[model samples]
Target: MAGGNFMHRVLSYVINEVVVNGLANSPAFQRFAVRTSKTLEDISVKASKKRQELAEQIKEASRNFDSFKN
Candidate 1:
């Protein structure tokens, strides 16, 4: 039973080391990270623009309402 447990621990260690090193050196992972960052930046810009447009529209609507009341 002890030998079996030792072998299991060794196998687990090797598998974890291989996976961690492989991911750390992967170009595909780097590209994905960059692409995700750019996409988030683009989305943020669009959201900012839309927010500004909505604010302008609300201001214009308020002005129109004030003119109508007068």
Candidate 2:
């Protein structure tokens, strides 16, 4: 059981070191970061438009409901 615990700790340490080094050294990470930033910006713009449309729909539904109640 102790051996298993030690091995787990060692493996975890190695994996973390590799990940830190890889991010620090990799060109792929840089490209991914740029791509992700652009994608996020696009998603933000689309989300804002969708939110506005949803608000309009909700307002119309509320007005219709109010008319029916009266």
Candidate 3:
């Protein structure tokens, strides 16, 4: 168990070190960061539009129900 734990820690450390070095010095990582940010922004916009459409649908349903009650 202890040996496994030691190996896991060493692997984590190495991965973290590599990521830090890459972010600081790698042009590829820079492009990756930009692309990731743009993708996230696109996702956000699509989510917002879907939310608005759902809200409108709920409002229409509520209005129809109110009209039927009268």
Model 1 vs. true fold: TM: 0.68
lDDT of 1 by residue, 1-70 (tens): 9999999999999999999899789999889888999999999999999999999999999999999999
Stretches off by above 4 angstroms in model 1 are 1-21
Q: For model 2, what is the error of residue 62's alpha carbon versus the real structure, in angstroms, after optimal superposition? A: 3.6
Candidate 1, pairs of clashing residues: none
Model 3, position 8, has a per-residue lDDT of 100
Candidate 2 TM-score, C-alpha based: 0.68
In angstroms, the error of model 1 at 67 is 0.7
C-alpha RMSD by candidate, in order: 4.4, 2.4, 2.7
Pairwise TM-score winner, candidates 2 and 3: 2
- lDDT on C-alpha atoms for all candidate structures: 0.97, 0.98, 0.97
What's the lDDT for candidate 1? 0.97
Candidate 3 residue lDDT tens string, 1-70: 9999999999999999998997979898899999999999999999999999999999999999999999
TM-scores, in order shown?
A: 0.68, 0.68, 0.68
